[model samples]
Target chain A: MAKAKLEEIESPAMLEEFYRQMLFIRRFEEKCNVAYRLGKIGGYMHTYVGMEATAVGIHHAIKPTYDYMITAYRDHPQPLLLGTDPVKVMAEIMGRSDGMSRGKGGSMHVYDIERGFFGGWGIVGGHIPLGGGLAFASKYRNEDRVTICLLGDGAANQGVVFETMNMAALWDLPIIFCIENNEFAMGTRLEYHAADTELYKRGEPFGIKSERIDGMDVLSFHKDMQRIVDWTRENQKPYWVEIMNYRFLGHGAADNDRQLYRTKEEEDAAMKRDPIARLEEILLKRNVMTREKMEAIDEELTDQVEAIYEQADASPFPDASEVYDNVYTDMEPEKGH
Target chain B: MAAVEVATQTMSYRDAISKVLSEEIEANPDVFIMGEDIGRYQGTFRVTQGMFDKYGEKRIIDTPITEAGFTGIAIGAAMAGLRPVVEMMTMSFSILAMDQIINHAAKIHYMTGGQAKCPLVIRGPGGAAKQLSAQHTHCLEGWYAHAPGLKVVAPATAIDAYGMLRQAIRDDNPVIFTENPGLYTVMGEVPDDREFVVPFGKANILREGTDVSLVGYSRMTQINLAAAEKLAEQGVSAEVVDVRSLSPLDMTTINASVAKTHRAVVVYEDWKFGGFGGEIASRIAEESFDDLDAPVVRCGGLNVPTPYARNLELECIPDVDDVIAAVQKLG
Candidate 1:
């Protein structure tokens, strides 16, 4: 873990703000789990449990609506942090007419393109090249927008990842290939899936600037990510990053019995460095908020998340007639045989 | 068939496509063409021969031979507001990028709830040509037509090649624009007007008759025309219906033809068993059941991998003789 001493942003208000944002996401995802178990949500819903800092840290580094963002299935937090109404996101997960994709895309397909969040793509590593292409388009248009493409450690082994990295560097596009190395690829450990567990060095062979950074500490991670984002935008070139963290929950909502791959002891060890706890520790040290204030913030965010769940659950499903809507801009698909 | 007078020029299917491509690229600043060897090497079949010098790298991009990579990039580019025409050297190689096409490009618009669209055209030669063998020769338009989000068109003539390519490049949906290698050199009088796009899902009747109808698409449409000529010599009047678009299929025209003729023979260069011809054949039976006199006959290529030997390859493809025999089977 490369260390960066926190100096400038150690202000009380900034620390309190970080605490609230991270806690809000934590509460939001916990509610998603509850929603999935109650059958209110359908299909595969991969919740962002232990990897809070990576998404929040990256959000702090880039302009939410100007810089483009894309990620593989484990979505929701990007748009939520980018200012997509958590109710609308939860509605999408609930597969309602008010959902972002009008219920056409369930949990794995949330999209708010007007905000520059390209998607909630399901296929692992399939969206990497697409992320590069988004950068390619911005470059072609001579826009200085940076594209942040997030994928998992398991996705690093996909052939298209390397193929896209080569093109991004060769084409000199402004993009960041951020591999959220949660150390687990859907029950398969990093060592079991990758020939090299050190996934950050993926860009080295492609002449892309690359490194690994500690993701548990949100402030440090944001500082490094902001620097990388600035470098990519200024140079109009691609960079590779591996944000080291761990997911305390199973891969998806359907995933049960972590004993299939990992042990309870290993899980317990990873939990010690939980990003939210680490951020709280920094807040306490800096006297950002009293213990009672921290407790009050937790309750408020939890209530907010509960309201989001109720609102999403109350939303109506899309009409049967709308099943064909948006299949094409100019035409509808044949309805029936 | 024109309601208004129009100037025309005799040209090959390849040249017709090239001319229309140049016109579209010149008109739409958002439109650009990209693929492996499509720029400097002038494309594998010379379809983009002079386009490099004409359009330059800004609009005419040459990419590494990474189909999945570039195809995904093209889809992303399309989603971001650029209309990209990605040329595959052969539609056979598109199988390498099926995940990108089927999973990403085809699903983006629908999944995004109309937030983003892939105004993309993936065009290249399909079906068998000479001894291109099993790997290079594949009639994949049927495969793409099966996907819901895509619009599939396989034009059979130089005129149609020009019209549909223009329509595809300007379309707001992802279109599978397939050109049979055999149709490249086929000549026709293509319209010289920029606004001469022949809309999709509208089948053309090349020859009208009452005895029977020969329905087909791509090069098989030409074969059906030849079969109509052969059927005419044998005292049978065969209507030639060229089904240029397969996805938004012009079943109205096909059913109309079946009603008049009371018999039909579907010709396709793809495999006989479980091919796109079966879809059309089944649709005709379902649609024109009361108007028909006999069951619809399907004359598709032999159910085997296309062999490298020219003689064997020819045997695999459905020809005029095959169509004639298929029509005779209806009796």
Candidate 2:
């Protein structure tokens, strides 16, 4: 899982774009924590703070039309990278009508069908089979599309995951099982949860090509993912990626200041390899962006976050009648079946 | 109402389902079938007999023995604007995919603010037949009808089977169309041209009467009809309502009939306690409370796991005798 040389990026524009997107997500989650604590954004918010690079890298590696995604509750970065309006996402978090899910699905269940991002599932391991199914359809229709089904280490324990893996492998579905093995499933450490902590080998029984990569480095993640996606796309075979990553925030904003789950030494050890800080270091060392340019990008993202907050604050809460609407498509029945 | 025209050609219930599937697939490219043992093997029950030869492997998929996986895939494909007919070899197998059927397919359309609609149909044989014990025999249409987001349809006759399946395939919402294994061999006339489609939420008044209204769906509809004839012998003119669609239940039809009949007996093959009968009873009680001259009696299977013995299984299922008894009690 060695990091790629900075010179490998032919154009610094793509690298800068990726860095900015990752930074925006980081800052957006930070703002979400502030808003959530102040009683603005309510109900279950799982932040993708440390695992931004993994999502950003893989999301950028494929076309939106050809690729569909389903992930666990740690999902804020996905919709943003998939081109959902940031203001709408913020508004939805605030339970406003303008939100991505029209205030029904707050933090966890953001869905953008137009953008080809299916949804963020709250139930662990529930969407694993769904992701596989999406890939199965792609291959069945001869669409030449691949679905990147993302999940955390906790979801890997689900029987449906293995069920889907075996079925996906047997069917030769064009799906990539992206496991963001962030070293912990909430408070339970990986060692305690999984017998063989190497999550990539979980795909071995299904004969799905598996790879373990340094999830902190965007370049490593992107390069490895590109290879896997291309292979899956060409061969229409399922593959797996075990991302060795960590989450900076607690399981949720609710878990803040509770260090009883882990020792301070372990927390500090993970903090030193902070994905954002490490990426910034790499950028500066490789001269992708000067210190001033990095500062400008940070300032721009801060302004965007502020604007998003303002827009959300201004948007109205969903109408009371909306609770009953949209449960089924209010489509008028056509003339014939 | 026009009587179903008796045609020279007749098909089995299994063939009716197959015809509906084939017609829908031929008419619309978006329509496809996916299930275990459905492709090269034709099907475990052979419901999709020549679908592989006609539509090829892509349209008639042979999935791994992963109900949850393929069901989920059907739901996803439906969301993406494909009409997917997912067959659970038996209702018991559907239990494995209940999460997707209930949570994803049923709830996603509403959860996504109507941006996604699952035009998915999960159809299969249900209920006790021969020696298939507790594990294999499960009448789950009642369970599915309880969910608000899904359309639950159980078509007993060949015409309703073909017509309702066509409707289910084209429905914008998720639908559970349960068939009966025992009824697969039941022969009935079917039109060659694929034009018939029964509307959802519409109940058929099999035999209009004034004494009592007997409600049933799927194979139970036939049992209720038989009971109605017996009830007539005892001077109880039982009006029979074949409830083809359960979720979007024709409350209008049931309420009107109860008002006229003054007494009702709900017959179901599902176990007692929280079965689909409860909903119908509640609806009748709520809408036509003053119309009832007698208490609404419910006739259903015994509330216990069905045993393997033929006699015990027969004892466990709601039959024509049970319907007669229930209607007599209403008198």
Provide the overall lDDT of each model, using Cα atoms, as 2-decimal numbers: 0.91, 0.84
Writing each residue's lDDT as its tens digit, candidate 2 over A115-202 gives: 8888878878888888877887677678888898998898899888888888888878888998888777778888999999999998
What is the per-residue lDDT of model 1 for residues A1-337, given as tens digits with 9 covering 90 to 100? Answer: 2233344454677677777888898899899898888888878999888899999899989988999999999898899999998888999999998899888898899989999999899889999989988998999999999999999999999989988998898889899999999999998999999998999888899999999999989988999998899898899999999999889999999999899999999999999999999988877786777789899999999999998888888889999999888888888887785
Fnat of candidate 2 is 0.54
As a whole number from 0 to 100, the lDDT of residue A200 in candidate 2 is: 92
lDDT tens readout by residue for model 1, B167-260? 9998999999999899999999998899889898899999999999999999999999988898899999999999999988999999999999
Docking class of 1: high
> Which segments of model 1 are wrong by more than 4 Å?
A1-10, B1-4
Candidate 2 lDDT by residue in tens digits, B1-331: 9977645359888898898898899899888899989889989899998889988977898888888877887787787778899989998899999888887788887777777888899998999878888999999998787666888899878888888998888889998999998789888877776777888889999899988999888898888888888888888888889888887778889999999998988888889788988779877887789999988888888988889999999999998888887876764
TM-score of each predicted structure versus truth: 0.98, 0.95
Q: Which ten residues in a row have the lowest lDDT in candidate 2 chain A?
A: A328-337
